[model samples]
Target chain A: MAPKSKEKPKAPTPQPPPAIEDLFASLHRNIDKSDYEKAVKDADQVLSIAPNDEDAIRCKVVALIKDDKIDDALSVIQSSRNLPIDLGFQKAYCLYRQNKLEEASACLRGRERDPETLLLEAQILYRQGNAAACADVYQKLQKSGIETAEVNLVASLVSAGKSSQVQKALEAW
Target chain B: FPPAFQSIPRNPIVLDLAYNCITFPDIENRMKKTRKGLISRFWG
Candidate 1:
């Protein structure tokens, strides 16, 4: 008998392309509703498709933070590839929650002029018992022409418990 | 603003940065919901 014909190896099955946009939108919807479980699920779905998806990773990190999973959030941030600027801010936030004000400040200081980082810097300064420095950061952020609720929120923190500063911040706002 | 933010006009900014822009404030709201009373000292 002729030698058995060589068997052809089966081709790998092709998977459908990741539905990135839909997953991202769903993640955003969950985040908006504070449905952190759904947000995480969606983010994980995106990550499963493209492990290096910075947005999805960041979303997962944010969902973790919102869900009060600080350590997990930080670990995710530390492990994410091509780390997004927002992840640094997110890490700082986790540090802040852990009451590591100085470390959080250091983390914020290492980032460039991310508006979010600047706001967190101010918050961290306030937590570190330097409202003056916090106020300074807030003023600098305002001077930079970026405005948002978090900026205003940090500005409020800078003035909290000080009537004069509160009055000034109120006037500025 | 980095070279990235500088190059993009406000009207034409992409969704990701805008999303990041929203994240911080969203965080405050989330904290209020999650941590409730503890957020008072910070926000006061």
Candidate 2:
């Protein structure tokens, strides 16, 4: 019988790489906990595994935005194309934050009727000093059953120097 | 809405609302406070 030799323990099979879902879950957990930096790192890990993962890209951009890294967020946004999800609203929001009102407005060209898009557009209009246009956009949102639009609508009217018509506008609305 | 963004509301806090009144951190004051905290952390 062969002398029992100390056999080198079999190298542990390399642990399978973490599931993408698991990584995304951790990323979302970090986001929920408001640990945006960690969330960004987690998102980067996910992106490393699946470079075109739309959800991962969105999470990273959102994490950067939350972290006040708007320039970085915009860079990621501008670099990606053919994204599975539309990030126009997010792009417009970043532009709006940067005070690029015209560029922000351009982003909403086809999405003007989306409630959130309309709200952002109205805000851009307000910033552009086109209070009348802002008020008009808000009125359209109000007509679309967006209750939050009412206050903004009144504010826009006031901004447009139509404070006296507040009551009339409310009644008509 | 982003937490960094604050809407400037007129008077009663509803009308004349200004979207995204972006405020910058007072970096000089912040740096002083950070330095004081670090010094205290190590030397206190």
Candidate 3:
């Protein structure tokens, strides 16, 4: 008969939390799976090590928005080390999504020159039923000599000024 | 909606509903602002 081994079996070691790169990979995986709350937690872990990381911060905001925690998202940016004003687009978006049209409209008030802010403002104005104002934003974007699919679409909506067209265009995007 | 997302009342095939909790059944409910903003920022 063979002798039994005297060595005891080793227990599995507890693994540390994933490295930042692995955490980001997990973040995208969670997002792809539409487990947004889990994605938020992953983003939080990423932010814990790199508090001012733009990608991590943006990921957190996006996950919060996806998880329908728009208010918490706004607070997340506000409480971050980054300046809240720098995230006007995100704040405006949260308000816009929450149907606080007036607040959304006001959030991008001073950023009219920024192309991103211009597009977001145009959308907010359109939702507020201020087509003329929305058209003005499109025109300004055109005059700025910046061109893109979004600008072209915004221009088309400006020309049509139809609510149904606006809805369709926004939806198609 | 969260409750509906969590679990349906009096549903037998509860396991089938498990997928709904982690997946977006409504595209319209996806955060357009964040999605669009992120894409625009990426390509803009």
Candidate 4:
């Protein structure tokens, strides 16, 4: 009689945590270098595993912005607002990018006084050729002692007749 | 004075830096560290 063969258990497939982490790391690198397409690809891979990752969503939005797809970025950010309050500023930024000045201002209105938001509003006004209004807002922000990079840049714009550059700078932001 | 300038509403810039979520020095430091980690791994 033949001896009964012992059955062996098959090994479980390993989960892909390390690979996901590597993908995020690569995405972060691409973002730092302003390589939007590669960053978007890496973020997509991470999102495949963790579909609702906040950082991944942010990376994808940034890539969309870098690609000059402002409307798409706005949509992504608007959808992300359901996640958390910290994402509110990002949503406002998307609105700004889409040239939805009123909506962007509304998103930021009555929030705690954010210097960046103020500067962003001023930039939007400048883009609309409301130079005096933009300057007034910039002066108010300056008087409030909120000396952010955005504030400085806006101040320069107000003084330099570079209103056209405001939109470009906001995009870079 | 132009009518636009005359009608320019004065929106007071609220001064509450504490409540504003502007990136502070500590946050900047953390971001730098994270950037460095990513750069070291990928760009190095």
Candidate 5:
């Protein structure tokens, strides 16, 4: 008589956290709709679970900016000392929003001359009403082939006398 | 605007708002004055 074969038990399937994805998706939707408070709440929930989550932190900052909480936004970025380059750019942007032209300029100056950083410098100049200087920076960036949507948009706004629009465009970027 | 206007202001509120906060009535007023001055001096 053949010995009866023992059946192996199947492993349990992992269940997804509906809350996490729902929160994240809600954050994105709020951002798209410019509902900053809701975005911040969702981002905060995500951050509580994953403190080092860059995307969540960024969303929080964006929410702050949209809500016109520039100081709070800058403080958040400044508190995060070891931020990545993109976040660094965002911090610089917060400075620009606050009208700290020199500090904002310094932030970009300390970093490598990438398209994004150069755009930030140009934006500071534009906001300071240095149209010629802003144009010069844009020209240089364009010559370097580092033109992004942000750079182009700032250039347009500078020409149109809507320099503050740069912040809005950058946030969207 | 002009290069002269690019000079940074000495006001603490202006400086702090420029480098720290999001929106300020003073900054907006200053920006309006600067823009108007720039327009009149250069564009006009």
Candidate 6:
């Protein structure tokens, strides 16, 4: 009898692509863990399946921002259309980092009172030599229960030439 | 500003605030919503 032929090894079954939900979960986890490079890559994968996925777009942009790819983040925001979520604050932040102060201030129009917005606004004011206005914004933040603003308020007062107010603010801090 | 703060720039202070306060839109929360259906016009 002829020896039985050795059976051919079966080819491995290709694994199915990951579900969008799974990809999204990973992206969120990466962002939460501050692993922004991985988050950006995961977001890009999600975007490939759903090109207009706003969640993916926003996550990618924010991850880029966190990763210090500010220009890329801003470009993505600019190019995307009809985003469900408003990324104005993030855009303003990118502009501020690029030293485009006036543009950053403009991007934050109509959202001046938001604590995040106020913080960015204060930074811009401080950079622009409007320390008094910056101090006022920091004071507002402090009144709103932001304890860290106390230190910033003292700094702004010093820059604004308010030595007496600085002493008071410092002591309070 | 104290001697220490005087040397530090606005960059660091606001960096902390931005990271703490500005959170990314949650993926699960946004995904749970049903997608809006396209509107169709009917001819009488």
Winning model by DockQ: 6
CA lDDT, every model vs. true structure: 0.64, 0.72, 0.63, 0.62, 0.63, 0.78
CAPRI rating of model 3: incorrect
Q: Is candidate 1 or candidate 6 better by DockQ?
A: 6
DockQ of each: 0.03, 0.06, 0.02, 0.04, 0.02, 0.19
Error of 5 at A90 (Å): 1.3
| Candidate 4 error regions (>4 Å) | A1-18, A143-173, B1-44
TM-score of 3: 0.53
Tell me model 1's lDDT, rounded to 2 decimals: 0.64
| Residue A75 miss distance in model 5 (angstroms) | 1.7
Compose the digit string of candidate 1's lDDT tens values, residues A1-173.
Answer: 99999865655665676457666666767878999988989889988988886667777887887787889888897887355445667777788888898887787775786666776776666667676676666666665565454344444453554435555554575
Q: Considering every candidate listed, which one attains the maximal lDDT?
A: 6
TM-score of chain A of 5: 0.64
Clashing pairs in 5: A70-B22, A98-B17, A98-B18, A99-B18, A100-B18, A100-B19
lDDT of 2 by residue, A14-71 (tens): 5687657667767766877989899888879878889987777887887787788989
Better candidate number, 2 or 6, judged by TM-score = 6
Q: Could you arrange the candidates by TM-score from highest to lowest?
A: 6, 2, 1, 4, 5, 3
**How do the predictions measure up, each by TM-score?**
0.58, 0.69, 0.53, 0.56, 0.54, 0.75
What TM-score quantifies how close candidate 2 is to the native fold?
0.69
Reference-based lDDT, residue A65, model 3: 72
| Model 5 spans > 4 angstroms off | A1-18, A83-86, A127-131, A142-173, B1-44
lDDT of 5 by residue, A1-173 (tens): 99888664545655765456566767766777878888788878877887777777777876787798878888878776775625566678877777787877877776887666766776677677676676566656544544253455555555656667667656655
* Segments of candidate 3 deviating more than 4 angstroms: A1-14, A81-85, A112-114, A139-173, B1-44
Measured with DockQ on alpha carbons, how good is candidate 1?
0.03
Query: Model 2: residues >4 Å from true position, as ranges?
Result: A1-14, A82-85, A144-147, A171-173, B1-44
Candidate 6, residues B1-44, lDDT tens digits: the string is: 45563454343233346555556776776342344434212211
